[model samples]
Structures are given as structure tokens and as C-alpha cells.
Target chain A: MQQLNEQANIALKRTVIVAIFAAVAVVLSLVESLIPLNMGVPGAKLGLANIMVLTCLYFLRARDALMMVLLKTLLTAFIFGTFSSFLFSIMGALFSFVAMWFLLWVGRDKLSFIGISIVGGIAHNIGQLTAACIYFNTSKIFYYLPMLLIMGVLTGIAVGIAVRYLVPSLSKLSLFENFLG
Target chain B: MKRGDILLIGLVVVIALAFIIPRWFDRDSSEKNHNELRTAKITVDGKLFKEVELTQEEQTVEVENEHGLNILKIHDYGIEMIDADCPDKVCLSFGFVDRTGGTIICLPHKLMVEIQGPAEEDGIDATVK
Candidate 1:
């Protein structure tokens, strides 16, 4: 009976943390929209929400991180995007999540978190452009690839530095020690 | 930055430079040798829609079809997307394309406006669009 109660408590704690992170991801995306980056390339943003997603991935289980990404993408699209925008965000989120997860799994401690974030950022761009090319049925969309790749590398460095600072601070609090993966 | 992070960034920068430097040279060479008039080729869904010469006089080209509506303004030997009905409006953000080999693309509407030199012999498919 004690084991069962403890298991239930852990599950509830996990659920609450995931929900809070998802909300944070949504808010970060809203904040991102207010900043205009006129890079002369279409569909380029700072990927601010990625900070929260990366934090979730590091501290929580893979399933929890995936859940946060899905919730974030859905809420952002519903609030501030169209059907096509929704399609693009969903594709980017999935690609970033998969890349991050696979790198974390394969590299273990050999790879820095910053490197993983960079790959995720680039993967996100690739996924969005893939969606655009398929939708338009034209390969011309690749013209923007170089610009987007450079943007990804720069922004990935920013997000990765942020997460590096954030994880330690959150872990220091010890509020959810049992929940940390 | 960690060793791995530096390595990763180096690889990405190299790849980006590989793609960008050649295009920069292409644009520079195209601009120097071509003294004739330049034209803006607009394509929709990979098909040529209209080819307009870039002149001193400003002109507006309205592209409306099943996909969406895009308003292009041409003036001062350059072309810009003045307005668009597409949801993202990314094409408008491209500002202006004044040089040969420059391009403005609207993905939602499947529209592309590319500046080309007079001596360019390639047809639509040669553009790789």
C-alpha cells in the first residue's frame, strides 16, 4: 500500500511539472513573436521556446519532454497561427525533439548539451523547409537553407547557454529531486 | 564552448559557407558582365507567370489565384512584395531584390520572383525551381 501511494505521488508530481513547463514554453513563444528578426529569410524566428523544451528534456523523461513540445506547439498554433503555420511548427517541433533525444541517447556524456541543441536547431529548420517544399511541390524552397542553417547555429548557442545555466539553478532548489531523470 | 560544441559549429559554418560563397560569386559575376536590361521572372507553382522588365517607372503586379494573392511592386530597378494575403506574410519581409540572381519567395502561395540577367539562356527547369 505504501509503494502504491508513493508511485501515485511521483506520477502526480511529474504531471504537474510537465504542465508548468508546457505553459512556460507557450509563453516564451509569445515573447518570441514580439521580437522581429529581419534576416531577409522567410520563416525564421529565435526559437525561444526551445529553452524550456531543452530544460524539460534534460530534467525529465523523454516522454515528458515530448509531451511538453506537443502541448507547446498546439497552444501556440491555436493562439497565434494559421493552418499552414501549425503544420510548420508541428514538423519543426517533432524534428527537434527526435534529434535531441537521439543525440542524448547516443552521445551520453561525450557530447555537450550545446552541441545537441545546435543539432536540434538545425533539424528544426530542415523539418520546416521540408514541409514547405512538399506543400509547394517545388524544390526552390531550398534557396533559403544556408541562411536558416546559420541562424540555427547562432540561436542554438544562445539557447544552449541559457539551458546550461538554468538546469543547475533548478537542480539546486531540490524541489523535485525524485522527478529528475 | 566545449570541444564538441566547437567542432559542431565549425562543421555547420563550413557547410553554410560552401553553399553561400558560390552564390555570392555568381551574383557578382552576373552583375559585372551584363549591361543589358534586367527582368524579374515570376513563377507560380513552378510555372512561369509573368516576366517584367525592371524600369525606372514603378509598377504593381497583382497575382491572384487559387493558392492566394500577392501584390508585387517594381521600381528603381528592383522588385518587392508590397502586400500579400498569405497567412505568414514572409514574402513581404524579403524587402527588395535589386541585383541579378536575387530572389523573393512566397511559400504559401508557391510564388517566386527572381531577377535574371539578359544573357541568361536557361529556361524554367534550369532554374531548378
Candidate 2:
């Protein structure tokens, strides 16, 4: 009975942490949207939510991270985006999650978090472009690829640096340690 | 940053440059062919909204639909999204697209403006001839 109770407590703590990460992601996206970082490239933004996603990926289980991504994507799409925006967000979020998860699994400690984040960022752009291409039914939309790639690399570096600092500090917290254990 | 991170960045930069350098050359070569006319085609929801020939006169086109409204300014040199009513206003940032393959897109409004050169490039040379 005591073991079951302890397991339930850990499960509850995990849910709370995931929820918190999702909330942070949504808020970051909201704040990011408010900032006019248009950069003359359509669909380009700072990708601030990536910081939260990367931090969650590092500190939590993959399942928890996936949950957080879904929460962030759905909530943000409903709150601050339209139907098309929802499509883009879901495609980008899923692609980024899969890429990051695969990198973590395959590379383990072999690859830096920054490298993985960069891949995630690029993958997110590709996914969004794919969604655009399908919706528009035109390959010409790919004309934006070169610019988007550069933007992805720049934002990826920023997100990676943020996660690098965030993960260490977050790991030291008792709540996270307890949940991990 | 790790060595791997540096390598990854280098690879992405190389790929981006590869895509961009060709387009730069294409734009330069196309500019030399002054006889070839360029046309800007704006589409909404994958349907033709309007098509304007690139000429000396500058004009402003206001596109109003149920989705949103976007104002496009067309000049002899290029087409630009001057204003938009969408939530993101990303279209306005597209600035100007002058080159043959250039484009400015407003995803929320399902609007896209594409610049097309004379049909010679697309194997439609018979029609041009």
C-alpha cells in the first residue's frame, strides 16, 4: 500500500511538472507573438517556446515531454492563433519533439544539447513549410527555405543556450529530483 | 559549444548558402534580360485573386475577403505587402519581391504573391515565340 502511494505521489508530481512546462511554453509563445520580430520573412518568430520544450525534454520523461508539447500547441493555437496557425503549430511541435527525442535517444551524451536543439529548430521549420506547401498546393513556397534555415539556426542557438543554463538549475530543485527518483 | 555543435551549424550554413547563391545568380541573369516581362500573380485559397503586369506605374491593390484584408503595393521594381489586418501581420514584413522567383505570402489570409518571368523558363517558349 505504501509503495503504491509513493508511486502515485511521483506520478502526480510528474504531471504537475509537465503542466508547468506547458504553461511556460504557452506564455512564452504569447509573449513572443506580441513582439514584432517579423524579420521580413513570413512565419518567422523567435521560437521562445523551444526553450521550455528543450528544458522539459532534458529534465523529464519523453512521455511527459510529449504531453507538454501537445498542451502547449493546443492551448496556444486556441488562445492566440487561427485554424491554419493551429495546423502549423501542431506540425512544427510534433516534428521538433520527434527530432529532439530521437537525438537524445541515439546520441545520449555524444551530442551536445545545442546540436540537438539546432536540429529540432530546423526540423520545425521544415515541418511548417511542409504544412504550408500542402495547404497552398504549390512548390514555389519553398522559395522561403534559405531564409528560414538561417533564421532557424540563429534561434536554435539562442534556445539551446537558454536550455543549457535552465536544465542545470532546474535539476537542482528538490521537486525535480524527487520526481526523477 | 561543442565541436559537434560547431559542425552542425557549419553544415546548416552551407546548405542555406547553397540554396541562396543559386537564386542570387538566377536573379542577376534574369535582370539582364530586360525584354522579358515579369508578372505578379496573387492567389487566395489556391485560386487566382489578381494578376498585375510589372510596369513603370506604381499601384496599390486592396484585397478584402472574409478571411482578412491585405494591401499590396506594386511598383516597377517589385511587389510588397504594404499593410494587412491579420493577427500576425507577417505579410507586411515580406518587404518587396522583385526577382523572377520571389514571393510574398500571407498564410492567415491564404494569400500569396508570386513573381513570374517570361514563359521561357518553364518550357513554354513556344507560346512566347
Candidate 3:
């Protein structure tokens, strides 16, 4: 019974790990906001925090990717986005998470989080574009879609590589070991 | 190393496709709408006065009045103050905005000019929403 209690405590701690990554996501998001893309696409971003979310999906035991996405969406909305803006962000986050999850499932050990991250980025753009369509009620805005999608793939790769490097060392941490509990 | 991550990457690839497909319609929208829609809004002294539509057949400007006595013509890219009963036609100073989210404001005439884009787009089938 004591072993069972100890196992439960370990599980609880692992769950908290997902929140840690979510915190990392929030911090990275804030940092990226400062970077400010000069790119003409208006509101363009690299989405640096995606690395941490992807990493969370890989290293943690639980299905924490979904949780991380939820937390990031809620936190980022409260901090940087307007009430109306949250709808758009939710669209992006949900899409990106699903994309990342899909990549991980197919490739398994062969595909790195880098690949998954890249896919997520592309989805992120589509997600936002989708939100734009719903909000504006027209398809004309899609005139910008191709450029945004290409950008999404490239930026996803960039974030994914960063996650690739961060994951190994992060896994070494005791805190990380118990993160997904 | 999770299955979910693999699924996600596939989803992203599909999103890339979403952007690619739209190029088809944009080509038609731009090529076909030789006389694309022009959206405008006018304001006088920080007050909204009139919003007009200027078509693409050559170039021209129009002014509307509530009293029904005056009609103003605006030349190509030539947005100027029409004789408004207001104190000044300062709004006449700000010109046109054709691109997305473009706006022009006239302070004295209380005229504001805003060129709006297409009101709506077709449904988006990309991931998420």
C-alpha cells in the first residue's frame, strides 16, 4: 500500500511537469513577441515556444501535449490577446497540436520532434487563416494563404530543431522526470 | 516518441496543402474583377459623416450631402475637402487607403476616408477551426 501511495505521488509530480513546459511555452511566446517580425505578412511570428510543447509531447509520459496546448492558449490569451482575439488563437493552437500529434504517431522513433514541430507550424497558420475566414465571413483573405503556409513549414522546422537540442538535457533533470505525472 | 506527435506532423503537412489550394481562386478573383470593389468611409472632425463606393472604371471621387444640394467629385487619387458646412475641411487632407486596413481622416471637415477590403471570404477548411 505504501508503494502504491509512493507511485501516486510520483504520478502527481509527473503531471506537474506538463505545467512546467506550459510555463516555458508562455515565456518563449512572450520572448518571441518582443522579436517582432518585420515580414510584411502582418502579425507574422516564429512561434518559438512550440519547441517546448513538442518536447513535452515526446519526453513526458502522459498525453501532456494536449494539456500544454490548453494551458498555453489560456495563458497567452489572458496575457497578450484580447477577448475577441482568443477565438483566433484557440483555432491556431488546436490545429497545431493536432498536427504535431499526428506526425509523432506515424513516424514514432524515426521522426524527431523537429519534424513534428514543423508540421505544427504549418497547421498553426492554417488554423489562424481559418479563424480569419470565420470572423470575416469571406474566402478572399485566403489570397494570403500560400505564403503563410510555406512560412509555417519553415518556422516549424526552426522551432523543432530548437526542441531537438533542448530535449536531451531537459530529460536529465529530476524535475523533468516527474513532469508528466 | 509518442504516437500523437506523429499524427500531429501529418496534420501540419495537410495544412500546407490548404494554403496551396487557395491560389486557384485568388487568380480568378484578381483577373476577373478588373473592376474590383472599392470600400470607403468618410469622417469629419473625428465624426463619421459618409461612406461612399468608388468603382474601378477609370478614377473618380464622389461626395454625398444630406441637404441634397451638393455633389462632390474626387479625381484619381485626388481626395480633397468638399465644401462642408463644418468649420474646416481638414479631413480633406487625408487621402485614400486601398490596401487592407487603410484609412484616411480629415479633421476640420470631419471627414474620414477608409478603403476596406472584401467584406467576406469563403469558408476555411484548415485544421483547428
Candidate 1: which pairs clash? Answer: none
lDDT by residue (tens digit), candidate 1, B6-57: 8889999999989999987876765564457799999998788999998768
Give the top-scoring candidate (TM-score): 2
For candidate 1, give the lDDT of residue A17.
Answer: 81
lDDT of 1: 0.84
What's the count of clashing pairs in each model shown?
0, 0, 47
Q: Whose lDDT is higher: candidate 2's or candidate 3's?
A: 2
What TM-score, computed on C-alpha atoms, does each candidate reach? 0.86, 0.94, 0.63
For residue A115, give model 1's deviation from the true position in Å.
1.3
**What does the lDDT come to for candidate 3?**
0.62
Order of all candidates by DockQ, from best down to worst?
2, 1, 3
- Candidate 3 lDDT over B3-53, as tens digits, reads 554555567557657766765566455545435565555543334566656
Best lDDT goes to which candidate? Answer: 2
Q: How well does model 2 score by local distance difference test? A: 0.85
State which candidate, 2 or 3, has the greater TM-score.
2
TM-score of structure candidate 3? 0.63
**Candidate 3 residue runs with Cα over 4 Å from true position:** A178-181, B1-129
- Chain A accuracy as TM-score for every candidate: 0.95, 0.94, 0.90
